[model samples]
Target chain A: MSGVEFVPLSLTPLLIGVFSAVACALPGNFLLLRRQALIGDAISHVVLPGIVVAFLVTGVVTAWPTMIGAALASLVAVVMIEAVRRLGRIEPGAAMGLTFTAMFAGGVLLLEQSDTSGVHLDVEHALYGNLEALIWLDAVGWESLLDPVALAGLPDELLRIALTLVAVGVFLWVCWRPLKLSTFDEAFAQTLGMRTSWIGLALVVVAAIAAVAAFDAVGSIIVIAMFICPPAAARLMTNRLEIQITWSVVFAVLSAVLGYILAGYGPLWLGLDNAVSAAGMIATVSGLILAACALWAPCRMRSGAPAQ
Target chain B: MTVELISDQGIAPDARHPEESPLAIRGMTVSYGQKPVVFSVDMTVQEGSMTAIIGPNGAGKSTLLKAALGIVTPLAGQAKVFGKPLRSQRHRIAYVPQRASVDWDFPTRVIDVVLMGLYRELGLLRRVRKTHLDKATSCLERVGMADFADRQIGQLSGGQQQRVFLARALAQGADLYLLDEPFAGVDAATEKAIIAVLKGLRADGKTVVAVHHDLATVHEYFDRVFLINTRKVAEGSVAEAFTPDALDRAYGGRLATAQMDRAAS
Candidate 1:
């Protein structure tokens, strides 16, 4: 076989997978920092009502309204969680569990009432995401920006990827210190004149947006997984905030691409399910990566230069 | 100590208010669950003075500090700083919690922790600029940890950890400082270094309140001591307030013996 054919027909899955991983990873760092690792799982579950409501209201499953509705719902979910904490004085984990479960149940009820039954609106797809469709969508190229030197069109997936990358880049850049300080010690951050409430809310909103964008491409489950696993792994490896973020993004992107390829072929060779379940497989891969990093990190730290 | 303020003597009636004072707690009360730990207590701390609240264990020393800083709500009382409430003047205060309170496994460096002190000053949605880094370096230098600026806080000795917190407080440059158990688990050298810095703060006209457990260092380390046991027993200069009569009143009969031993040593 020629090198070109062996280039991998599953390149689209890799692109979408990596993007989803990275998008979730940024917020994952903050979640872990704030000791809110389960928040990602909670947010994904709570966003269900928003998704179903958007579909019910519009009678269509388009991008804009679904995303906007989900974003607003995510914000509401966060507000409800905080309110519960204040009124009940309960631990955050218990509060989140309570809030997300109620919202998720409401979403299921709404879905049943609306009768928007289809492959597109399935709960499993909402939670785990559908990687196969995203890869196919990405393979078809879109119009490119006009160039004076080379007159060539760029792919639509490339354009989307570029836009998403720039958005994540700018967002992370602007909010770096506030994110770090707020994550490290929220009360201290409040003392320093930081708007701890606003920062926390903003992080939740950003995480929701990233999940929404990646949901269709990588699916919800894998996005949630990538958002959590990379940062947890990175925490085991380094003490520096900057280094942890850098390593987390690296690990996230690598896991996404590798998982895509592995899921594509592993089933046929190993007599597993033909469906492959790309989102679950990617999450499993990232989880394994975190485990491996934890196991080897102590030895690496001992042999390498001391923590600075 | 005769226990007389300038306000009481009528030399300066306004001295009682102390507008410049960083902390003013009036009728403060705190409770965990149903049991009240800190009863209604009133105190006014002058600006730029090193004041220590010394008491035996379970005397609500840390609880009082936490209530003043708004970490724990006062059931009935109000705490203010610089003539403003703690919420409004949060940026002007730096809190150095007990060294043993947090997990040492937290992933961060000494510089990172110190940088947190500057968070309020840097405001929100902005990265730490070169100016912030320079300030952090200078603060580390003040604590004689300039060489270890990049080191992880977990890798440091107990003394080093204490110094690191002091450096963080310095980086804040706040008008008020609330420290909880700063002297705990620290070596003699670390205690001396911390005291020197605190004394310098008092001289600079910044208010410092520490939750102190050692009675022996009351005279040496503090300009003023507030002996608290659930309620305010006495707050005045060390010579007058650290007397056997006041100690007995503050600690009761059981602790009076411990106080006697400390005094004898």
Candidate 2:
């Protein structure tokens, strides 16, 4: 189980981290524009019950059922929030707060009430992802990637993140104009026959898919951070939509790489003898980047050179 | 109650082009909750002319424009453009909502906002081609903000922003242009520039409908006027409908001051 192949071993965590961060950040831009950053948090909380229920119903832990279940749960969460807002005559923020809490608690209760076996789904995993344990055990260098055994040993989480990132990229590519117009000016977009409410719904659903796909490998905390910080920081740096998207992806990848390296090596370099949580550190890095942008982004700030 | 005036010079609408009347509202009743805002309003705007919708504050001046654009849901009646529904004819219509209706601080350049005018024609899944970008650039040049094409919208002054919006509507290339309060807080120069643009549109044979506030410029700027106070008070040429009696009826003693008549004169 042990080999001195340091390259492929470390590459696993970094690749997985970058893919997951990029996936979350891509859709995070729209959530930021639409002011639905909190909805990302809500879906992360709600997807847990979906996974556990999928596990119980199928008696197996696979990607397909969990994806469907999580997607459904997020939709249910949105409808429930709307209903609570309308029926209770409360504001939208209050409705989201009330709905997510109740659904999250319900998810926890559902997990406990079910007697599922052979599934690793749990609350702690949902909160803090199992990032450290995903190292490729088939130990090999880059050349060994062509080996069947090495290919098989590649963490399935990496493949999952890869597919999710691709989906995010393609959807944004196809729907760029409509999405941009709707976000900037909904009423005018409608006057142009965009069917804005429906487009708005599609945006939410796509964002939900990204959140849910990320949940299994990276958990909710990092997903939630990646969903808000990178795009926000990019916003501080650019005014164009396409450029903002690129900058956000770049920032997200930086957060993932920097966070993973520091979390793994910073403690050892300080003689603490153990790695820290990569997920928490990544979130912290994104926050630091955002804070830095707000203070010194030259496009808007007077005291610095522009970050462009 | 609905009011309809047969203008002596009003060209009879083309039958085959029943939808060709630029804008026609019939029995439009708009209410917010239990309170009625616009009640059974009926009016028709002739093509190739500038028409003003005038009313006191809270008189539903803006609401009528919104309902006609289907931006606001109407409690009763329908709005048509060029003898067809607003939905089917959306592409032929260009809307310039109030300048304050959007977040000026949004992270988009002046050119991108103008480019939005081309989105309908570009449709989904199509990139903005080089030809379209050239068109958008020309639109910006027309508004005299070509130098600020890359500038963020927030950097512009109020008058500059209004001109940018006019530039966007100009890029829309629609036959009917609907503007809501374009001159609400503009400078005198900006007002002159806007009127010049409107005149240009009229000269090009495009129809324009604006929600106007100042009574002074009504005579100079508009060929026709619709005076209302939750109802259509009168509709005719400025010389015909801008009467002291009709002004009194709509304003109800609010225009008892001498300046009111002086502004009209």
Candidate 3:
């Protein structure tokens, strides 16, 4: 176990999971705050066309254009939602449903128009992830830590993940009061001279960036699970905004690690030929955790309550 | 001007010009989609007066207030506050929306809500300091909620929640306040407390416009009333605006049989 040859095969997925948890949790807390959980679903699906278009134009998969294209696509999604709001006077959820379905359909059309190979759209790799295979890539590297037993290797995407998480965390920390008030009572927020539109736009931007980061790691399907489930679970446990955010981060990180380990060992343990995808497994666990948390929260609240 | 008009009906005080008007809306129209909710309405809220915009449901009372706050775009007319456009005079106005409009489950405290009232004054990118926090505490204290400053807003009762909103508005320290149905669903104690706070605002020479539904309480609560039914029916002292004629016009056939004794008295 001390030698490099004895390094855990689950290390790569575990790292990916940890990073995904932290990245999604920050914006997930905000999305939960705004009651715009569906926006995560919208951004995840909408980014497909952006990535596809970028690939078609650039003839290569680069991070800059991919992220930018995804951001633009997310903006388009917001505009579409606003247009539906203005024209149809429909509820926001309905608008989100209409826009995402159309954008996702457009993405499918783009993929068809480009005639990308059957292997190109690889749902298996995209939805579930191929973390074990990625450990050999140019970006993932191992760093020697102070402790000989505990070695920390920095991956290529680590900086982006770390910086995004830190920046978002600090941004929310600084704007916590405004965000809290704005999310709670937008009308009152407006009266306070806070620019509601700008705050709304900032939230959208945060959602888009978080979605983009998760897009490359686990693809669209898992991003929603990471973005919504943890915060929702956190919401059940706490009423304080700061505590909820903190709990969400903790839950996400735990789910990621648990999901990664489960996916790695399930094949050997259960005699399954194809183990579940790491992202799918993590998302499933998160959903289960949220459901369990929801069911038990009321009981706990009742038990703790004094005689009224 | 000194003579009171009296007929077989009753004595009517001469409608003297108010010392000042804080808000005025002229020929205002608001539409949702193609259909109009407020049509060619004209209203004026006097300075230092607690005015209530009253009508039955869907009478566009809230819409009129939104127009005054510049929250809703008017299709035809303009709303001026303190002799200036609402956007330019944003700092002078404070708003308290109905408590139902916000998610109580949101993770925020009473103090946090109150501090937000100072955001416009504090400007963007500037961190909130001890002074802002102190102001928030004082505002909460004014609402008699300073003890619950650290309590989550969700944990409070409906009346307490309403008081938190009032505290947030009070923290704004604005010259004008537009509250949308602040008394609805509130307990009697909370209602009296709110009225006291409104009177305090009036005493400070500020203007208040509330969208109210309780016909029984309107006269007792407001000095001025704007009777609205898509369009302005009348605007004057509560005694003048709460007449049988205005009630008939505002409520149509409904007011003929369904009379609250308070409306007549």
- DockQ metric, candidate 3: 0.32
lDDT of 1 by residue, A162-212 (tens): 466667767888888877766656666655656777888778777777766
Candidate 2 clash pair list: B18-B83, B19-B82, B19-B83, B20-B82
Off by over 4 Å in 3: A1-13, A118-120, A136-155, A269-275, A298-308, B1-20, B121-134, B256-265
In the range B46-140, model 1's lDDT, one tens digit per residue, is 65567889777788899998888777767889887888867678777888887765545567788888887876666556667899999999998
Give the whole-model CA lDDT for all candidates, comma-separated.
0.76, 0.83, 0.76
- Greater DockQ among 2 and 3 belongs to 2
- In model 2 chain A, which range of ten residues has the least summed lDDT? A299-308
Q: DockQ, per-model, please? A: 0.35, 0.41, 0.32
Please tell me which predicted candidate would have the highest TM-score against the true structure.
2
Q: Rank by DockQ, highest first.
A: 2, 1, 3
Of candidates 3 and 2, the better by TM-score: 2
What order do candidates take by TM-score, descending? 2, 3, 1
Q: lDDT winner between 2 and 3, please give it.
A: 2
Off by over 4 Å in 2: A1-4, A86-89, A115-119, A300-308, B1-19, B125-130, B253-265
Q: Candidate 2, residues A1-308: lDDT per residue as tens digits?
A: 23356546677878888898999999899889787788888889888877777777887778788878888889999899879978888887788888788888988898888875346777888887877777887856666667887788788888888888899899898888888888878768877877887877787787888888777777888888999999999988887778889989999999998998889888999999888888888888999999999998755542211111
DockQ score for model 2: 0.41
Worst 10 residues of 1 chain A by lDDT: A137-146
lDDT of 2 by residue, B78-191 (tens): 999988888889999998988877777677888889999998778777777899889999988777778998888878878888898998899999999999999977878889
Which of 1 and 3 is the better model by TM-score?
A: 3
User: TM-score (0 to 1) for chain A, all models?
Assistant: 0.85, 0.90, 0.87
Docking class of 1: acceptable
